[model samples]
Target: MQLPIKKTIDSVPGGMMIVPLTIGCLINTFAPDTAGFFGSFTGALFNGALPILAVFYVCMGSTISFKTLPRVAGKGGVLLGSKILMGILCGVVLGHFLGEVPITSGWFAGLSTLAVVAAINDTNGGLYMALMGQYGTADEAAAYSVMSLESGPFLTMVTLGAAGLSAFPWQTLVGAILPLAAGIVIGNLDHKMRDFLSRATPVMIPFFAFALGASLDLHQVWQAGLLGLALGLFVLVVSGIVMLVADKTTGGNGVAGLAAASTAGNAAAVPTLVASANHAYAAAAAPATVLVAASVIVTSILTPPLTAWWARRVGAKAQL
Candidate 1:
C-alpha cells in the first residue's frame, strides 16, 4: 500500500522545508555524532548545506529570463524596489539598536537585525505567482521575474553592510553572486539548459534545509517561535503596505503588492549563508534560521487570505 507521507508533509505550510529541517534538528540535538557513526555520503548530506545552496542558487537563477525583465520591468521593478527598501529600512533601524548580536534573554531573546532583514527581504515567489494568477493581471504575476533577484543572501548582506553592522569583502560579495550570475548567463544563452537546471530548484530545497537544520539546536528553534511569528506579521503588515502603495502608484490594484509580502521557504537558508560569509553574524545564524523558517510557514499560511481580502477590498476581479 502507498503511504501518505508526501501528502502529509504537503498539508502544512512550508512543510517540505520545515519537516526535514525539524528532523535534522532532532538528530543533531539528540544524536550529534550520528554523522560520524554513519560516515560517507550520509555524513556529507548532513554537512553540506552551503554547497547544496550554491547549486540551488544557480538553479533558481536559471528560472529568471532576461527577456521577461523588459516586459514586466515597470510593475516588477516597483515591487522589487519596495521589498528591498523595506527590508533595508528595518535592518538599518534594528542594527542601530541591536548591533550584529541577538538578544540573549527575556521574550525577545534570539531576535537580531540579521533575522529581521533576512525574513523581510525575500518574497515567496511561488506563492506570489499563484495568488496573482488567481486575483491579478498576468503582468502582476510576471512581476516576480524581477523580485526573484532576492533569491539568496546578497541583498541581506548589502542591507547589513549599509546598516554598518558588518562589512563583507568585495570578493566575498562577488563569490556570493557568481553562481547565480553564471546561471543567468547560461540560461539566457540556451533555453534547454535553462529548462534542465531550473527543474532542480525545488529538488534541492529539502537537501539544504536538512543540512541547515543539522547545525541548529532545538533549544534555539524553540526560543525563536514567538519572535518568528512576530517577524512574519511585521513582514506582512509593513512590507505589504509599502508594496501596496508601490503597486497602486504603478497603476495596479495592490493585490500584487500584498501577494509579494510573504517570505520564501528558501529564505530560511540565508542566515546560515550570511553567517558563513561574516563571522559577526555567526551568533545570530542558528536562531535566525529558525526565525526565518517560522516566517516562511507563518507567511505562507496568511498571505493567501490576505491577498484575497485585499483583492476584494480594492474590487480587483479574480481571474478564475
Candidate 2:
C-alpha cells in the first residue's frame, strides 16, 4: 500500500515548509545528537540551512527580469521600511519604559526591548518566498532581493541603536545580497540559465526548512514561557498590520506584507551578536535569544495560514 505522504503534507497550509520543519524540531529536541551520530551527508542535511538558502535565493533571483527590477525594488522597499519602522517604534517605546534591562520577575520576566526589536526587524525570507510563490506573483517573490538586507544582526543592531540600546561591517550587508546578485547577472545574460535555475526554487524549500528547524529546540520555547508566546503574537499582529497597509498602498493586495511579518529562524542569534557588540545588552542577551527562538517557531507556524487567508480575502491568485 502506498502512503499518501505528499497529499497529507500539502493538505496543511504552508505544510510544505512547516511539516518538515516540525519534524526537524522534534528530532533535534529529542535526540539532540542525531547529526553527530550520523556523519557526512546525513549530518550536512541536518545542518546546512544557510548554504541551501543561499542557493535558493540565487534560484529565486534568476526568475526576475531587469525590466521588473524597479517595481521589485519599490515593493521591497515599502515592506522593508514598514518592518523597520515598526521595530523602531516598538523599541523606542519599550526602551523608554523598560530601559536596557529585561524584566526579571513575574509573568513577563525576560521581556526586553532588544528581544522585541530583533524579532520585529527581521523577516523570514524563506517563509515569505514560499508564501509568495504559492499566493503571489514573481515580482512579489523577487521583492525579497531587497528585503534580504534584513537577514543578519545589522538591522537589529540599527533598530536597537536607534532606541539607545548598540556596526555590523559594511561587508556584511554586501555579502547578504551577493548570491542574488550573482543569479541576476547570470539570468539576465542567458535565458536558458534563468529557466534552469528558476526550476530549483520550489525544490529547495523543504531542504532549507528542515535544516532551519534542526537549529531550534522546543525546550527554548518552553523556557521562554508565556512572555515568549506574547512576543511572537505581538510580532505577528503589530508588524502584520503595518506591513499589510504598506503592501496594499504599494499596489499589492497585502499578501506579501503579511507574509513578511514573521521572524527569521536565524534571528535568534541576533541577541548574542548584539550583546557581544555592546556590553549594555549583555544582561538581556540570553533571555532575548530564547524569546526570539520562540518567535521564529510561532511565526513560522502561523504566518503561512494567515497569509493564505489574507490572499484569499483580497482575491489574490495562488501561482501554485
Candidate 3:
C-alpha cells in the first residue's frame, strides 16, 4: 500500500498547511527534546517561528510589483482597513470590560486582548493568495503585499496602545516587516528576479507553518477548547462580512474579501510578543497564544470552502 501522506494532505482544503503543523506539534510534544539534538539548529530553524516567518515574508513580498501598486492598494487597503477596524473594536471592547486579564468567569477565560486582537488583525495571507489565484485575478493575489503588513504583533500593540493597555516601540514596528520591504524594493527593480522568487512563495507556507507549530503545545489547545473555536467563527462571520462589503465597494465580487477572512498562522506568535512588550499581558499570554493557534487551525480549515461556495454563488448570479 502506498502511504501517500502528501497526496492525502494536498487533497484537503488547507491540508498542506494543517498537516505539517500537526506533525510538528506532535513531534514537539512527544519527543520534545528532538529539536535540541542537532546542535539546536532545529530549534533555531523550526522552533524560532518569527525568524522563519520573516524569511517567508520576504518570499511573499518578492512576488509583488510596484507597477501593480495602484490597483493593489485600492484592493488591499479596504481589506486592511476592515481588519484594523475589527481588531481595534475587539481590543477596545475587551480592554474596557475585561481590563486585559482573563475575566473572572471561566466561560470567558480564554478571551484576552492579545488573543482577540491578534486573531482579528492578521489574515491568512498564503490562503488568501492561493484562493484569489484560483477564483480572482493576478492583481487580487498581488494585493497580499499590503495585507502582509499586518504580519506581526505591531498592529495588536498599536491597538493596545490606543486602548491605553500598553506602549510600543516604533522601531520594533518597523523592524517586523523590513525583510518584506527589502523584497518589494528588489522585486520592483528586476522582473526576472520577481518571477524567480515568486515561485518560491507557495513553498514557504508549509516551511514556516512547521516552524510555527513547534511553539505550540497541544494541551494548551485543549485548555483553550470551545471558546477558541467560538473566537475563530466570530472572526469569520464579523470580519468576513466587513471584507465582503469592502470587496463589493471596491468593485470586486467578494471572493478576495471572503478569502482574506481567516486568521494567519503566524498570529500564534503574537501573544508572546505582546507579553514581552507589556508585563500586564504576561499572565494571559500563554493561554492566549494557544487560543490564537487554535483560531489559526480553525480558520484555515474553514475559509477555503466558504470562499469557494461564495465564488460559486457569485458565478451563478453572474450567469443569471
Top candidate on TM-score is 1
Please write out the lDDT profile of model 1 over residues 43-146, one tens digit for every residue. Answer: 99999999999999998888888988999999999888887888788888999899999998999999999999999889999889999899988888888988
TM agreement with the true structure for every prediction: 0.98, 0.68, 0.83
Over 1-320, each residue of candidate 3 has an lDDT whose tens digit, in order, gives 97987788777545655667667777777877777887456667666665656666677677767766676899998889889988888778888877777653567766787788888899988789888878888778888878877876777888887876767678866765577787787788887888887788667768766765666677766667898899889888888899999998989999899999999876776787677667888877767876777787788889989998999998823211
**What is the Cα-based lDDT of residue 113 in candidate 3?**
77
**Model 2 lowest lDDT segment of ten:** 165-174
Top-scoring candidate (lDDT): 1
Residue pairs in collision within model 3: none
Where does model 1 exceed 4 Å of error?
none
What is the TM-score of candidate 3? Answer: 0.83
Across 1-320, the per-residue lDDT of candidate 2 in tens digits comes to 99999999876545666577668878989999999999899999998876787787688668667765576889998999888889889888999899878888777878888899899988888789889999998889999877876765667777776776443445654565678678888888999999999899778878877876676677654667788788889999998989999998988888999999898765765676577566778888767877886787788889999999998898988874
| Candidate 2 residue pairs that clash | none
Q: What is the C-alpha RMSD of each candidate to the true structure, in Å?
A: 1.0, 5.1, 3.3
